[model samples]
Target chain A: MPISPPFRMEAMNNQSSEIIYTYAGPRTASDTGPFVKTRLMIREFIDARELIIRLFIRNFSSKYRQSVLGIVWAFIIPIITVGMFMVMGNAGVINVQGLKAPYAVYAIIGTTFFNLFTAGLTACTGSIVQAGSMIVKINFPRIALVFSSSLMGIVDTAVRLILIAAAFIVYRTAPHPVGVLIGFLSLIPLFILTLGLGLFFSLVAAILRDLINIIPFATMGLMLLTPVLYPIDNSSALGVVTQYNPLHYLINFPRDMVLYGSSELTTGYIVSAIISCIVLIAGWQFFYMAQTKIAERV
Target chain B: MADSVITVDGVSKKFSKSVRHMMLYGTLDLTAGSFGIPLARNRLRRGEFWALRDINFEIKRGEAVGLIGANGAGKSTMLKLLNGIYMPDLGKISIRGRIGALIEVGAGFHPMLSGRENIYINGSILGMKTAEITRQLDSIIDFAGIEEFIDSPVRHYSSGMYVRLGFAIIAHCRPEILLIDEVLAVGDARFRRKCLDHLKQLKENGVTFVIVSHNMQTIDGIATKGIFFDHGSLRYCGTPGEAISHYEMKMLGNDAPFPETLIEGSTKPGSLRLVKYFKDYGTHDIRFEDVRITNAQGEPSESFASFDAATLKVTVASPSETKTRMYCSFINEDMTVCMGAYMDISLKTGIQTIKIKFDPIQLTTGRYMVSLRLYDEYLTNPYANGHFGYFSVMKGGCVETPGTNTPYCWRTPEVTIA
Candidate 1:
């Protein structure tokens, strides 16, 4: 049989305009350069949000399915870890300066918050490798996978915070309203920082399988460097380290707000939020740049 | 004309096996080598290999194309690039419409989720909006034919049912461009046929398709054009028939010769006569008897059609007393058995003759194989036997291809009528 004639050929004359307008559904281009490019980026952001929500819900539901105590595992791990640390503190195995509160309460709050940060980071970092098959088969924003895993950590954190509130009520200790508000506000910056780190880690893990083994050790070290178990006072070497740690402000902001009724916003919190924003933006840019290589690598 | 839907321009994707295995830390260590001067020195040691080199093609709207290749031939890599699952290392791919892919169908399906819930989840993963899936839900369930079990967890589904549901959802996607990779061969015959028919219907509705398959017959039935890949490069791209013939030529070079006889005849009552037969008397090829049939009045006939009344007669010479059964059968060219007749009788010493007349031969219009079997029928069991005698029936002649339709032409003002 004779082969059919070749299909119509159309040369792309205005390539830049096509790329910008096509992303936003055939928009009329009135300006050139960065302004038009930003419009295309905004469209990509909207598309990414839609994909993230679905993946987040799917990942969250599948993890807890068929368990008798469905989402309670999220709360149970933090409670148990904090309880073990509280026992060490009460037995005079560790020392805390400048605090009269029960050692169990203080340890639970610190460990619970720090665990949320590290667990969220590790899970998010491994998301790309875990969903390797999906990455190779489906077409979507690759960063959605990393972000969804980080968001699932937020769900776990919400559960742990509820347990902390219950402990405070049981002990007949009232948390100041300002402290509770600060605790809630601190989560936003923590999530942003974790997401950025997760995307960077996920891309690295997808390309180099060895990163899967290394992430746990890195997160453990980060936890130790932060004051999750001990109190941070104004006049000590460990306190200076805690004050300097980027994640330290995130953990401490919530504890300071809920445990002490102080509403003073520190320069540390301001610096941490700025660092979180920079990381989140840079992390997204690096992930998108590396994602094209992931389909081949994975 | 400027109406092309896809344009792939000088695209090349190179993949190195060793570089893929290299750790991320290795790249960092190499780059971190004493800042500027050492970085230039370390770069000279890296290696590069190419998988796809300078490939180019264009697909217009409403075209159905097939991608054919051997196991490692970069056909899958090409599909991944088109779907935006992978980017080309060099050059560009531009596609102008909504694209849906069935590359590893059910890739994101969760076993714990019910079929209904998974439909939404899997649909979103394939780039469908929730509202779009809701609109297509009824059609998907109808096509899958799993409405009764839609609420059941997918873990309970058989592998076939899982694939059926996956294909059905993809079919309902209403994409402007669809990419399918060997997914049609996953289900049972009925579902496979259904998927092919649905794909054909979609092609007619102006949806462009790119199908990848090793099955030549399936590709021939659907693809208007085909591209063959050999060792990560385009070896041939043209008409489907030419592409399939090219693939078959390569496959035949690797296969052994066809067997002389696939089946041995049964031994029973009212069977064909055997003059001589041997199963292992030849080297590389088996040898058989010069078998023929005669009328009851003892006359020879060269041919017997199913419409003719005939008698079966046999004459055989044995070295000693033998107890065996005789068998006769008819089979089609494709090796489908049509009908059979057999007889068992006792023979004693040398030159034994057997004759049996059948009322009529019942068969369809096709070529068939006639086989006879002889086996020992005594000593322990009276029904055990050996086999012999094989021939063919060229009944009702061969089938012819259907005639093609001639295009009608009319006189135009641009052309002068003679």
Candidate 2:
């Protein structure tokens, strides 16, 4: 096995022979067709693994080192949001219903899962714009930036998962053993959907500065629409809109598995998993094609 | 063709003049590109102009190619294209080796991170592996000359320290092809010399170089070949000397020939003759008609005895009234300027002669060249400059030091007892 440098994927030839990179007339890697380009992109990603790890370390360390609260900010944010919603429930501002488990356990699990999508989406969307200087100066694989930022999101979510674990212990709520495993497996689709949309929005957000400002609000509104804080009201008109929301099934399936050990939403989960895969494939293709123009605009 | 590491063939690039059109067209093009819709790339749309129009060049392996042009002459665009930061619109560019660009070093440095930690991050961004960075860690720190502050956060580092560390990391990457912009003039003068020496060593070790600089002396020192760009078109590509002269002529907008051919009859009784090789640049408000060195006997001569008095007479032709200063510098064969003299002159619209006398010209025995530069009264803008000729100084003065002379006397020592 050859130990090539991590920034560039070598061509088929060895080091002695030259590797020719020809760029012409607004063309890019996708001109080779989607399948071949995707294969090449995978190889480039593999070659850029070390760079991804380094960038992740850089972002992860710099982000918390400057803050007074440090890593606690990750858990504190969702904890506060959960506290506010509980206060509203106590005040009778909103009705909390349809829970076999305690409302604290239910809401904490839901917020943790929901945060995986929202934070991941936000991080991925801003990755390219935040790395604007590096993008213009260097010729490294751009997908590495997204991957590193996505790792940050995953780490953030992992921190929040600790809060969920603490909530379970504090409430003495016993989750179904088999359901725990199934609930963890269900997070795969949610993560895939977040990364997929992140790939799309990151590129678009880099071009349009307005999307950078619009995304947090959009995801906040999405959280309300997806029933992340409360049980879905099936009889309400707003609940009808939730029927088409894929995040509803992706987030709810995991929570239902831990609470009920099985869910009637399995069919909906399967459909949403397929949708997530589709978004991922399409978003990857779009990101790959448009990345070559990024330096010029940024 | 196999030996050519970089080949840019008929490449052209365009940019939008207005920010609104740039965003609009960028979005439209991006959308069209994402949808796989082929648009007319060769044609320019509204509010767009060609930044580079049909440029063609090839750089062979182990060659140092210097790129020279005025600001916004597409030199930077060409460098960006070569580095794969931008794709061409009308032609193709092919490059064959791992490239290390010193275009803007320290661009990726995180201010909050320690210098030692940022080195690993910047090294990886430049394509060095972690193991490689670890191996070169001590050397990088040594090269940056900041061992004491390596662990300090770069936010506290001086700007000079920041660039030094950045350059140190990239320099150790051992790239096959190196691209340098106007970044070599960083840090202090000693550090700048160190960088140039290192670059020279790299060149000897067969690292191909593409340097873009406005400093002609630097380009002439390093570049085996020079490419001059004017108005987005390649105006000349040849030897470094010829390319620089051509570029300088264009910059001054002068039509006069550089290094005028030899002539016989111009030498008069009391005026010195000029050598065949001479370079001159000016606005033609005033021109050097004749330049000569006269010995103590008051006759033009090329060879002077050491410790003898000499007069440098410069005759100028001016078409209008102007006040300018003449600066004449004596340079040895090593091209080191030994001594210089200046005269402030106000000339009317005619030919006139100005003579500067040097009493006891004490330059040691050697051959030396005379360069005359005419500047405005404040000595800021250069109006004309020329190396008129060279003169020889023969052995006559007391044998003393090897460098230029300063007036001195030795007092007779009196015997004393303490």
Candidate 3:
């Protein structure tokens, strides 16, 4: 191995280099600069990758082990949700205009993609609280819990994509091949934004239990405001609300890409992506700072 | 300085008095922290109090330190802080090398998962790599002795099986520093013995340990050093023997040093008490001042080898010339009187001393209590009686007996061919 600095730490063989952890009174900044602290956090997270995978497998298998439906629940919920919206649209209880795709295809795509954000955020938010005893008794990267739960959400969303594919087969509709690829790419920003909010909400929800009960309702409300079930009429009041909602651009960009081959809201999508990145970075820093006391409070 | 593996400076930690306050303050802190405003951590806010206050200690590499304290005396808090679960509100703690804490075994086990799978999860949570766990899988299963049930769901396993599997995984993790809290006696006595033997082997291999236990025997048997915490303060830290004594003294209301006497019950002048002494009842007229047990070499000691000569010395202070019956009995730890002796003794106005010697004290390996009594001329209505002290007989004997080692010989027998 090449020689390195005196302060650098090697995991198992640190005979030559020293690693010291000094915990003192609360301070606004770590003894090391933010840049070094961020590096160390990232390194610690990387070192715990195995634990994250194991946790993910543990939760995934246990969640379905006792149920007869098992993995089918992943697609069942989305299908039932889309079926409800299609029924309402047929009855004219919900009206749509200027939509290129069939109502079934449009509703399926919207519900499944929006479900990614809602389900991912809800799972991530509950991860820390669900592992309360483990957090108090063991010392590991707390972010591993959030990451593993988010992985579960991702895998669950992947399963729902099979449902979306079956919907297109039934409707005899073909999505633009390039737009579909870009649409999958667009889910990255949405995932990042969900993770950022999940990190922040998980931290706060552990301290205030009301947030745990409040998140599902809040996500449902957000879905209505974001036009996930219907097309946005620019003159309607809900359309005005969608204009200010970041999720509006995040969800519509990918759905529009898969449907209409391209989106005219590129500027709004870029701005929302930037906002997602910022939220992720800020949420990560806050989680890192607040994790020290989580064991005690929990 | 580099050899010191763990250093806890003047560290302190605080907790809120109420859950409502905790939620409110947590929300406030998060909100304020987003604005880059730090909380007043050095001082206490409303509904906050220190759990551990300004504690300091250092453990050199390979030193096993035992923490002894009463319930709620901050021993667990100190362990949590050492494990980096909680940050200090004041001062600092610096530690080198990896730490593995056995605060609660099977902490992350999923009920629906099999033991084989939960081992990976639990091991990874303990900072072990997947390859390391795979390498140690068979050994972990063998050590836990649950191979037949390894593939079964953990929820179906008994609590003992669960703990054994958990401990087996952590024991193989090979942490540089191990911190344990009252989890030593996890399963049956046999399993406890196995765990203790494993800990001893680890200590021999230079694994640093910090253990918190209320079982003094466990601490004395394993730890090189002992720390005593009382009411959130470090009362003493020294060799395990001395720290145990200090802790015992404190726990017994600080009335246990040698030569310190306590008088129990009312010693009326002419009451013909027809019953035994309740707890060291004594009349001040004729009393035993000092009592001690000495070894064969005539040096005061509380422990002696079996078949070794021992001495018992008693100092008496009398008001006037009086005659009393001196009675002494050797009682085993189970309160059974193994031997007794009595003699008529004369005492002067001032102080008098008596010495009794036993050649080859025929006691087996165990602790024994000494009871001394001074009865009046009638050999009843005792002037004073006290359970003065205790001593122990260690190894070095031909045979082990319940009460005493009796001198005997065995005849050799010749076997005939069948």
Q: Which is the leading candidate under DockQ?
A: 2
| Per-residue lDDT of model 1, residues B229-307, tens digit only | 8776787888876775565455433342323452444344334333233535222111122344544344555345444
Indicate the DockQ of the complex predicted as candidate 1: 0.29
Docking class of 2: acceptable
Q: Over 4 Å off in model 3, which ranges? A: A1-34, B254-418
Taking the tens digit of each residue's C-alpha lDDT, what string does model 2 give over A31-52?
A: 4655767676687788789999
Local accuracy by lDDT, each model = 0.66, 0.79, 0.78
Docking quality (DockQ) of candidate 2: 0.36
Model 3 DockQ reads: 0.30
Q: What's the true lDDT of residue A88 in model 3?
A: 88
TM-score of chain A of each: 0.84, 0.89, 0.90
1 or 2, greater by lDDT:
2
For every model shown, what is its TM-score relative to the native structure? 0.74, 0.78, 0.78
Per model, state how many residue pairs clash.
11, 0, 0
Clashing residue pairs in candidate 3 are none
